[model samples]
Target: MALRKIVVLIYPGMHPFEFGVTCEAFGMDRSDDGLPVYDFVVASETEQPVPTLNGFTITTGHRFDEALDADLVIVSAGARGGTPAAVPATLAAAHANGAAVMGLCSGAFPLGEAGLLDGRRCTTHWRDAAALAARFPAAEVDPNALYVLDGRVYTSAGTAAGLDLCLHIMRAEHGAEAANVVARRMVMPAHRAGGQAQYIEAPLPPAGSDGLSELMDELLAELPAGHTVNSMAARVNMSPRTFARRFAEATGTTPHAWLLRQRVLLARRQLEAGHEPIELIARRSGFGTAALLRHHFQRHTGVAPTAYRRSFSAAGPPV
Candidate 1:
C-alpha cells in the first residue's frame, strides 16, 4: 500500500533521537523537490506532555487513535520497562486496521507486547536482542540485521539503524529516487553495504606498523592485478603463513576475505557511477569474469549487480 500518512508514537522516557528519525523522514515539507509530503503527526495516549530521556518534554496534541487511519505508525525506543498497556492496545488496533507498523531499537518491545511480533521475524539493538528473544519466545529475532520486515511489522537495530529502516520503507513504497532525495537531504548514504554486525564493539587490533596497510593501498590502486597471498607476502618479505597470521591480527579478518569485501565495494561504486557493462566492471573489480562477479556480488549483497545498478544509478533508471 502507498505510505502517505504517518504517525509517530511518543511516550515518557523515549529517546528523542529515535523519535526525531521518524519526524525527519516523513514530517518535513519536500514538495519543492517533487517528493510527497506525508500527513505526519506526533501522537501519544493523551494530550499531555511526554518527557524524553534527556530531561526534556515534548507536547503533542494527537492521540493514539490517530494511528488507526495512518499508513505507517512508528514507535521509537521507550523507557526501560514493559510497554504501557495503552501503547500496545493502540498498536494492535493500528495493525488490525492494516497500518504498516514499525518499532525502532527497544521500541520492538512494545510490538512484542502487542503480539504483533509473534511468529514473525524481527530485530532490535544487538545488546537487547537476547532480552527481546527471552521475552517474546515466539518471535524470531535476528541480532545482526539492520532491520527486519515480516508481514506488516518492521523492526530495526540501534539508533542510526532507524534511518536505514526509514529509507528502506521509502525506497520500497516510493522508489529509489525518493529515498535518494531524502538521504541527500539528511546527508547520509541512501543504502549502506553491511548490517549492524559491523557496528558491534570488538577488541580493537593493537596499533602498530604492519606492512599490510601499504600493501592494501597498493592493491586497491591496482585491483585488476592478479595478487595472491603468496605474491603479497613476497612483496612484504615474509612467508605466506606469517603474512596471513599478521594480517588477521591486524585486520581481524583473513586477507582473502578482506580483499573480496574490498572488491565488492569497488564493484558497487562502479555499478552506481555509470552504465559500464558487467564484463568490464568484473575485470576492473578483480573478479576476472562476469560470472565470478555475479556470484560474489550476490553472496555479499543479496542482490544482482544489474538490479543494484537500477536502484542506485545516477541516471533516472537503468535501461
Candidate 2:
C-alpha cells in the first residue's frame, strides 16, 4: 500500500526540529507538482497544547488514536525521561494494525519500552545509542547508521537524519524521481553518501605531525597509484608498525581503511557529475574494475554505482 496518511505524535518537551521534519515531509500540499498530498495529522496523547523544549507550545485537535489508521506513525523526539505510558500502547496498536511506525532520535525509547524494538536493528542519536542498547538489551543498535528499518519499524539518528529517513521512505514507496522532486523543493540532497560515522566527534592529530599530514595529502593527490603499508611507512620515515599505530591514534582508523574511504568518496563525486561508464569511473577512482567498484561502493554507500548514478547523475544514467 502507498503511504498517503501520516500521523506525527508530539508530546510535552519534544524537540521542535524533528517535529518540523515530519511536518515538512508529509503535511505540505504539493499536489501541483504531481505528488500525492498526504493526510497528515499532528496528534498527542490527548487533544491538548503540548509544550516544547524551547519554551513554546503547539496546540492540536487530534489525539493518539489518530495513529491507529495512519499509513505511517512518526514519534518525534522529546526530552530525556521515561517513555509516556500512552505512547507505547498507541504505537504498538498502530503497528499491529499494519501502520509503519518510526522513532526519530530519542523517540526510540518509547518503541523500546513497547517491546517493538525487540530483536530489531535500531538506532537513535549517537550520544544516546549506548543508553538505548543498555536499556533494551534485545534490540540490535547500530550507532553509526543514519537510519535503520526492520520490518515496519524505522528509527533514525539525530536531528537532520530525520530528513534522510523521510527521503528514503519517499524513494522506497514512490520512486527516485518523486524523492528527487521533494529534495529539490526542500533544497536538500536527494541522497547522502556514507553513514553517521562521518559526523562523530573524534580526537584530531597532535600539533607536531606535519610529515604524516603531508604524506596524507600526497596520497590523496595520487590515489590511483598503488600504495602499501611499507611504502607509506617509508615515505613517513617510520617503520610500518609505528606508522600503523600512530595512524590509528590520529585518524581513528587504519591507513588502508582511510585510503579506501577516500577512493569511494572520489567515485561518488565522479558518478554525480557526469555520464562516465562504471568501468572508467572505477579505474579513475583506484578500483581497477567495475566489479571491484560495485563490491566496495555498495559496502560503503549501500547502493550500486549504476543505481547511484541513476539517482544523482546530472546527465542521467548512461546508455
Candidate 3:
C-alpha cells in the first residue's frame, strides 16, 4: 500500500494551535516507530505566507492541487470570523474526491459553510456551538462532545480537542498501539471517552454562598445515590427557583444540566469498576431510568453504557 499523504488547508488569520497540531502530528517525522510515514503538506488557496494568531508567519508550501487525492485533508479553524464565513474551492474539491475531511473547532463552521456537515453529527467549540447550529440547520451539532465522526467526515470541538480527534484518527488508521505511541510522546491521555461534558469546567460556588462549595462537593458525592436540585436546594434552605439562579451563577450551568454531567462522570467510575448494572447505575446516578441514563450516556458519551464499561473496565479508567 502507498504511504498516505496528509494535507492541511490554511487560511488567513489562521489559528496557530489548530494547524500546528497537524504539523506536530503528521508533518514532523515519527519514523522511529517504523510505521509507514505520511507525506505532509500545507496547502492554501494562495501559496503565500499566511498570518496567524501567534504573530509569526507560516508560509504554505502547496496550493490546492497538491491537496488533490490527499488521504486526509484538514481545514483548520481561524482566530477571526472567516472561520465559518466561506469554504474555499480547494477544500470543497478535496472532500468531493474521497479524502477524509476534518474540521477542528470553529473549523467545523467552515465545513458547515461548505455544506459538508449536513445530516452529519458534528461538534465545534462550545463557544461556537450556537453559531454552528444556527449557521447550518442540517448539522447535528453536539455542543458537549469532544469530537464527532460520522462516516468519513470528522469534526472536533475546541482547540485542544484537535489532539483527541487526530489521535482518534490514528487509532482508527493504525490501531491503539500507534495512537498510544503518539499520545505518550505528546504527554497527553491516549483516549478520552465521550464528548465535551467530561471536559466541562465546573463553575465555582459564589463568594457569598458560604458553605455552598462544600455543599456542591457533597452534592457530587451524593449524586451517585440520587439527589435532586429541589432536595439539595431545600437542604440549603433556599427555594428551587432562587437556588437555580444561584447555581447557574456559581457553577456556570443550570442545576439539572450540571447534575446530569456529574452523574455521567460517576457512572463512568462505576462502569470502570465493573460492579454496577445499568439499572443500578441509573438509580444511583439520579437518572431514574436506564432509558434516560442511556440517552444521556449516548449523548454525553459517544459510546453506549455497556460498551463503555467493557472498553474502559479492562483499561482500568476513563481517560
lDDT of 3 by residue, 1-319 (tens): 1339988888777788898888877776788986557888887666568777778887766777887788788888875255523345656777788787888888886777677889999988888888888888998988988888987788888767898888888887888999889988887777875363534644555565645677877887788666677887887889888888887777778878888888888778778776566898888888889999899988877778887776557445445
Instruction: Give the lDDT of residue 235 in candidate 3.
Output: 79
lDDT agreement of model 1 with the native: 0.86
Clashing pairs in 1: none
**Candidate 1's residue-wise lDDT over 214-246, tens digit each?**
787788788888888999899889999999999
Error of 1 at 5 (Å): 1.6
lDDT of each: 0.86, 0.85, 0.77
Worst 10 residues of 3 by lDDT: 79-88
lDDT-superior candidate, 2 or 3 = 2
TM-scores for the candidates: 0.67, 0.77, 0.72
Superposed model 2: Cα runs more than 4 Å off:
1-5, 29-39, 46-48, 68-71, 80-83, 96-98, 125-128, 144-146, 158-211, 312-319
Better of 2 and 3 by TM-score: 2
